[model samples]
Target: MSTTDYLTQGRRVLEIERAALATLEKNLDAQFSQACELMHYCQGRVVVTGMGKSGHIGGKIAATLASTGTPAFFVHPGEASHGDLGMITKQDVVLALSNSGETGEVVSIIPVLKRLNVPLIAMTGRPDSTLATLADVHVCVAVEEEACPLGLAPTASTTATLAMGDALAVSLLHARGFTADDFALSHPGGSLGKRLLLRVADIMHTGARIPMVPTGAITTDALLEMSRKGLGMTSIVDDNNKLLGIFTDGDLRRILDLRTDVHQTPIDQVMTAGCITATADMLAAEALQLMESRKINSLIVVDAQQQVIGAFNMHDILQSGVI
Candidate 1:
């Protein structure tokens, strides 16, 4: 085929799938709401099952549901018959996907599911098919046609099924009031979790590692502390460990321009008072935002009484993968 023909064919495929999704949107009725309600109230996991391409889509749906605060998992229908059916419990809800609703392996498990009294939610093109007829809730994922020119392959149907699954998951997610923090808890290893869930206390320097000096300490002494702590700045605190001010490398350069006697000048004389501070419980991502917004590289983490307890810099956030 010529390049133009190939491009035309690809566009046709996309257009067909787009139309299929549009049809799905119009067809959504009370049945979609009922499915969401069933999954929402399910005391146990949402067990997704299917065969072939539908199986792949079902697995993703199960994953999305699980990550979005819903407890869910995927079970292969073929394996369910080989003893995995024991995984299904009375408390769980079964989400069965079959465009035809008559895949032999999926259909064969209906009796067992029925015996276990697990609520069945079917996504299928045929509302009257055995799977749909037997399900407690039927989510019609019917597509006008396959994206394949020959109309043989599973294309548009699978897209529609996946979109329906997304719609169900998001609806249930909202109904449950699942927050970003809740999502981060489930995905602690993912970037979103690092940004939303990780706190300043989890990554900030503490104890002896925090660059700090007494308020009356000389500029030379504070610079020594900053060098030793390697944070580019030293927090000047009172005898009670309450933060008084901060002296940074930038301040040192400015003081040097004035030819200030570093050994004689008290660190507090050159320090920036009322500097921004963070709490240990504050999210590291929020700290990064503060740094970027204020054009500062470091922050002193304080207690409720404003005592310097921890410290962190831009490098800490980058190292912790919170950037």
Candidate 2:
């Protein structure tokens, strides 16, 4: 085929699927809400089942539901008959997919699902077919035509099914009041999960690693602490370990600008007082935002008694993958 033909085919396929989803959106009815309601209150997991292309889409739908707060898993319709049916308990709900609503493997299991006393939700192009007629809730995902030139492929229908699945997952997600923190717990290894759940205490340098100087220390003493800890700044604390001020390389530049004697000048006289501070419990991502918005490179972590407990710089955030 010519290059223009490939381009035309791709655009036509996208337009067909787009139109299919638009139709599915506008045609949503009471059954969609009833399906979400049933899945929301299910005591056991949702068991999704289908055959052929529908089976592939069903697997993705199941995964999306599981990750978005609803407990779900995919079971091949053909396998449901050979002991896998045991996976679907009476307390569980069934989401079966069939474009024609009469795939033999899927249809054959409808009676068993009914006998198990479980709610059956059917996503089908044929609302009048056997599966839809047997289901407790029938979500119609019918499309006008397939994206295939021969009009026999599953393109538009599968896209519609996937879109409907997303709608169902998001609806259940909203109804459950699932938060990003809850999602982070489910996805601890993912980047978004790290950003949401990583706490300041997890990455902050503490104990001897925290660059700190005594309140009566000279500018040279503070500069030495900064260099020793390699955090580019030093927290000046009093006898009680309470934060007094902060001396950074920026303070050093100003010290030299005035030609002050670093060996004789007390850090309390030259350090910036009341610098931006963080608590050990703050989110690292939240800390990154505080640093960016305040135009500061480092932060001092303090305890309830206002004692300097930890400190970290922009490099710390990058190392922790919070930036």
Candidate 3:
């Protein structure tokens, strides 16, 4: 096939899958709600099981459900029949996936699920198929056509199934009032976790590390402090350690344009006063937003009395992996 033909085929597949998701969205009804309630109220974990390509989709669905405040795990139906069925409990809910809803390995587990009194939720393309008919709640993921031109591959149907699974997981996430902080608790090792959980106090330079000058200090003193701390800016504070203003490299440029003497000028006279400040408890991500919105590169961490407690710059946020 030519390059254009390859592109055309790819577009056709995407179009088919997109239409499949649209159909799934439109067909959603009380059955979807019923399925959510079953999983939400389940005292035990959600046990997902399927065969072949359906199993791949089921594994992803289980992971999504688990990450979004729903306790879930995938159990291969073939394995379940061999012995993994012991993993399912009466308090648990089983989610089974199959395009035809008649995979023998998946169907064979129905009697055991029934015996354990575990609630079964089936996702399938056929409503009248065995798995669907036996399930306590059936979510129809029927699509008009397969994305594969041969109509032999589980393409659009699998995409529809995964979308439906996401719908259920997100619905449960909202129902449980899951917060970003709660998500960060589960994902605490990566950059995503740092962005969600890292606070200003955690990354801000404290004590002598903070570039600060007394209220009556000269512009030269502020410049020296900035150089020593390597933060590009210095906080101006009063005798009580309360923040008065800030002097940055930009402020020095403006003063230089006026031909002001850095040694003779008081920082307070040339500093940028009433600058934006952040609190120690603020999320680093929020601090980043404040910096970007105000078009500034540094933030002074202050107390309730406006005392300069800490400070950080854009580079600190980036290096801390909270960007």
lDDT of 3 by residue, 118-162 (tens): 999999999999999999999999999999889998899999999
What ordering of candidates by TM-score runs from best to worst? 2, 1, 3
**Model 3 CA deviation exceeding 4 Å by range:** none
What is the TM-score of each predicted model, taking all chains together?
A: 0.95, 0.95, 0.95
Which lDDT tens digits does candidate 2 get at residues 180-212?
888888888867888999999999999989999
RMSD of each: 1.6, 1.5, 1.6
- List clashing residue pairs in candidate 1: none
What lDDT would candidate 3 get against the real structure?
A: 0.94
Ranking by lDDT: 3, 1, 2
For model 1, residues 43-127, the per-residue Cα lDDT tens digits are: 9999999999999999999999999988999999999999999999999999999999999999999998888888999999999
